[model samples]
Target chain A: MISILKNWVRGSNKLERFWLLSKIEYKLRYYENKLGLVWALIKPLSEIFIYYIAFEVIMKAGIPHFVSYLFIALVLWNFFVESSLGTIQILATKKYLYEYTNMNKIEIYLSVIGSNLIGLFFNILMFFVYYIFIEKGMYVSWHIIFLIPIVLNLVILSLGFSLILSNLYIIAKDIQQIWLIIIGLGFWISPILYKLDTFRAALPGLEYINPISNIIINARNVVLYNHVPEWGLLFWGLIYSVFFLLIGLYLLNRLGSKAAEKL
Target chain B: MELNKEKVAVIARNISKTFYISEDSYNTVKKRLFNLFNTPKPKEVAALKMMNFQIDRGECFGLIGRNGSGKSTLARVLAGVYPTDTGYVKINGSTMLMNLGVGMSHELTARENIYVSGSVLGLKIKEIDKVFDKIVDFAELREFIDTKIKFFSSGMIARLGFSIAVNAGAEIMFLDEILTVGDIKFQEKAIKVFEKSWIDGKTVILVSHSMDVIKKYCQRVAYLKNGVLEYLGDAETAVNMYIAENK
Candidate 1:
């Protein structure tokens, strides 16, 4: 374990391979589309606008730039959902490369999460630009710095979760179906569409247990509310990320070369 | 028939692998949840059973077996595709699985797939650029290099795949039934390359059902039966035993 960790830090080959694969994967996602990555933004923007029409214009749940506010959190939520579902199929899909070459199987999962992150990063940039510059004077503050940790933590959590899901998915494909239901339920339970402040008051325990709630709430705090994410919660989130990562590594090691069996 | 520098190339010791076939192949979450009430267990089949063998450096070896006799499984295990159940497989030098379409992407053009598969075979893009023309020339697909592989005939794709795998410069090459493909002319050229360098040096393990090809090319051969090493010795004897058993 020490040696493996040491090699990861010392060697750059794995990182290089990760970059090559993710670059291809990211490019391939929009390869066939004539409009290219505009489609990536268009799909989410359309969904957010529908919600905006219902909540802000129609229902008068108007709380500041509520549309962009809602968009920011929903965008982050989509990243997790997309990354989770996408990562589940990475190993099974790329079985040929990892099976044939000396390439590490974990590279498949890493490259997938890495590739999805580029899209999520762009979405965040677009939303923040519209929120701060175009929409104007929403009390932008130093708390915006927390957005860095927010994205980093999301990637870490996703990688950890993905490592576990992709490995289990090899043997028991039922996990994918179960994951779909969990992801569907995840959106409702998390504070993506609703206010975190309300959830904090109404069901504080849910906020603590559900990491997704923390991520969405943390994103909203930096991007919209202009407030610092709770440091204690953020610390817990880091620990949560580490725990998942360790568990993911454990499960992957347990599966071993047996992963290619079902494939 | 032995070279002076007869170093050990591959030492495979007591390797074994078992695959579990789920009773319900399509066990979705709904069915699995239901199966919790009245469950059926996955059935395990040992694909390779405690097998030991070695191939010398600069040797051309053939693995022959009946279908499902673990010939391909052994190659895959040695190639590090599937992990063995319990054993050691130590192979010197870079290894590549020469099964046609080992990493061919149908959506990508033949040129693009060359890069994709070349990279998968551990070649940097720059390295592929240096040998790109040679690979294209060898496959004789220069005109259709940029055409998507899906549009190409099966033989064309196989030829392209074979060309890339061969030129990838793997010191230990594992050719799994790819030699049997392509035209007579191409096979003749491939056989020449085999006789010239494949015999001169660079260990090659060929897994094929063609006894004639095995007898013609292999210096020594190993015969597998139901995951067991049934025979390992002179090529002619192994081939005769294999042919007789199948008969």
Candidate 2:
């Protein structure tokens, strides 16, 4: 713990830099658009609407409180998808930052993920607003606090994939298309628009393999169901995130040395 | 101002760098599958080969070479942008490479660019705020502060880049072809700034094609010929060597 504190103090400068770069990234993303900030909300909202039309109206999943249920999981999942995909080309795109300055390579990944986190926060805020007005009889509970760790888990998981994929992307550009297929399948595999128990029986040990599954499960438990998170699953999810993060950071340090040269 | 010749600021020992240019990159799995038995070997280009040099603290050192002579590569290696293949570079102070429009996002405004590049230089936002006005004033870009740099001329961009390096730069600065851009007036202003206060107690590694700017400021110069240090001594001899080699 003391070491962690020491690292935080030492990293105060990097943290400050990360915050500024992320803000620039988030702003620059919508800089040219007329709607600007509103586009952040529009993306996830539109995704939820389309999924709702397909799952609830047409297919008739008929779970409970479908909108909020899907919104909670979709918001978390979108952050992972967007952040990882956005970062695949980050080392090449943001070469200017590190090529001339003494900026650490990890900071580039942080800024991109941090920008996605901003979008995630905005969508979560919209989720709460929806919960209050649109969804009736759902009481606010302390279980909501669990969303913090769940969100952090999602961020870490996305950062892991970002680090790994971006490093591979420097070597091979085809990781982009391959990752798209993976995430498309991942979207269906997780309980985003479907029931968890149905897939849990079919694909045993999925929560352990797919960290997003555990995160979605925990998020829904805390926000919608008002139940405490499955502690076992939370522990496993944390393990998976950390495991991925360690490997990603390792690959970044090892294979990412030729990043500037390759790009 | 006399520099502190006692303390060493930058040191490079037997460093070399080689780049591999692959004719065919099997980026996709399909390409990899089809070419499973035989893969194309990458062609090697030796950017720098067995080079060694050191600069004292606050020394105005110049690096002169013809195009593709590894001057920029050596500068980058010393600036810690590119790692050497064989040896290491030990820099005693913070370093910044002031290449052409480097670290400046064309899509960002001058204000935003300043903050981004400043932060990368290890300055906190509050710290940048203190030096913000001075940077804009020195660049003579007060009016275009909020405008995106993409709309600005290359000369204006160079001025902004130079100003940022002057104000918010590191202790050890690698200036790569910074004088090539900008108008003659701005170049004169930049030369004046360098002469007046910028070079005081700062280790500057200047890479330039202009012999006049180099001869004026450099106490010593290193002339590189095709990745090898051909000459390292007085500025006049090195400049003459580079010119004669060109002919």
Candidate 3:
């Protein structure tokens, strides 16, 4: 546990490094585009619009505030997808540091996640703005306080999966292709466009097992529905989060030093 | 005169390293499983032999060898960049490896690279900020500090890399062919900084094919002949051994 937070006490310089690198990464990602930072919001907004047109207009979905609902889910899912995929490929792009310098291995992944967090922050803030003013469903409730821990827990969980994927990616170059397929399947598996209750009502036991579905449900209850998240489910989510985090830490410790040599 | 062994800055013992250079092994699960039942083809290239050496604090050590003689590998192993296959390396203080473009991103500005590169060398961002001006001044790229590095010339990049590594406050420095980079003026400026580091008593492990540099900068030198430590004593003997073997 201390090992995870050890970067902090080791110095805030690492935190600054993460921030600086993440900023450059975030900028480099979109600086080439003519649209600049507007491209960041354009991705999820267009995604939300397309989903709205598909399920709401064509299928005539009965859910109220469907655009807002889809926006929240799409934004969060985009973060997850970008983060995991970014984590997998990040080492190859940033291998210069390890090959040429003495950088710690975990710093690469942390910066990847940090870049995603920058994007996610804007997306979440936009959702809240659309929720409180333009949309009628959510108010600034005390339940929103739980959004902090909820998102953090999900980030940890996603990082765990990414850590495992990154190590695997080093050995297997085509892991990204396989991971892309898994992520595509994962989108429909998680409760994003459809309501979480539909999943719970349709398949009672499976929702409890899928951590992705659980995070979406818990997040929706606090941010979208403004209902208290299920504590029992969150407790399980926390357990899985911790479990994946431990796995990631172990793999990174083992494979990190060897990463440069293997490359 | 013998240096104080108790104040050793780096100790490398029987360090051996091999690279799995064979491309026959499957990288994917499907491919790996298809060939699982078959006997695996194994091939390895030994980069370093069972080399043992120790550098006391304040020693300027040079490694000289022909191309692919594992001089860079030995320097990297000593810097803890590559792990030894069969032995251990112990470094007593903060270390930096000085290579071409070292750890800076070309997409970033010189100012931007300073912060991240400094942090990569284990310096705090605040500490980096304090030396930021000094780095730019040392690099002689004051006019181009905010300019994106991709726009800079090769000489400018080398200057920036040298400035950061020298100012990173690492006690032990591993330099690999970095002295050969850039123009004559930049090299002269870098040698001045290096002379200062020597006076300040920093431990330096310099790997260069230039005999004049090894003779001028190194008090003691080691010559590696195909990953074997052929000579490890005075600079003159090592340089002579290197010249005799190469010719």
Clashing pairs in 3: none
Each model's DockQ? 0.44, 0.61, 0.58
Q: Per-residue lDDT for A45-129 in model 3, tens only? A: 8888888888889998778878877887787788888878767866667876677655677888788788788888988888887
* TM-score of only chain B in every candidate structure: 0.88, 0.89, 0.90
Better of 2 and 3 by lDDT: 2
TM-scores, each model vs. reference: 0.88, 0.92, 0.90
Please give the C-alpha DockQ score of model 2.
Answer: 0.61
Candidate closer to the true structure by DockQ (higher is better), 1 or 3: 3
Q: What digit string (tens of lDDT, one per residue) describes model 2 on residues A21-116?
A: 999999988656899988888888899889889988999988888888888888888888888887888888898888885567998888888888
B35-106, model 3: which lDDT tens digit per residue?
Answer: 878846668788888988899898889989898898888888888887788979888766777778677777
Task: Compose the digit string of candidate 1's lDDT tens values, residues A1-263.
Answer: 99999886544344555677787788878657799989988978898889888877888875777777788887888888888887787776777676665556777777788889888878877887777677766757888899889788888888888888877886677788889988888777887666556767877688778887778777777767778897877888888888888888888887745666666
Mark the regions of model 1 whose C-alpha exceeds 4 Å error after superposition. A1-13, A139-145, A225-228, B1-10, B41-44, B55-57, B90-94, B195-201, B243-247
Least accurate 10 contiguous residues by lDDT in model 2 chain A? A8-17
TM-score: the better of candidates 2 and 3:
2
Just chain B of model 1: what TM-score? 0.88
Give the alpha-carbon lDDT of every model.
Answer: 0.78, 0.86, 0.80
Return the lDDT, model 1, position B109.
Answer: 83
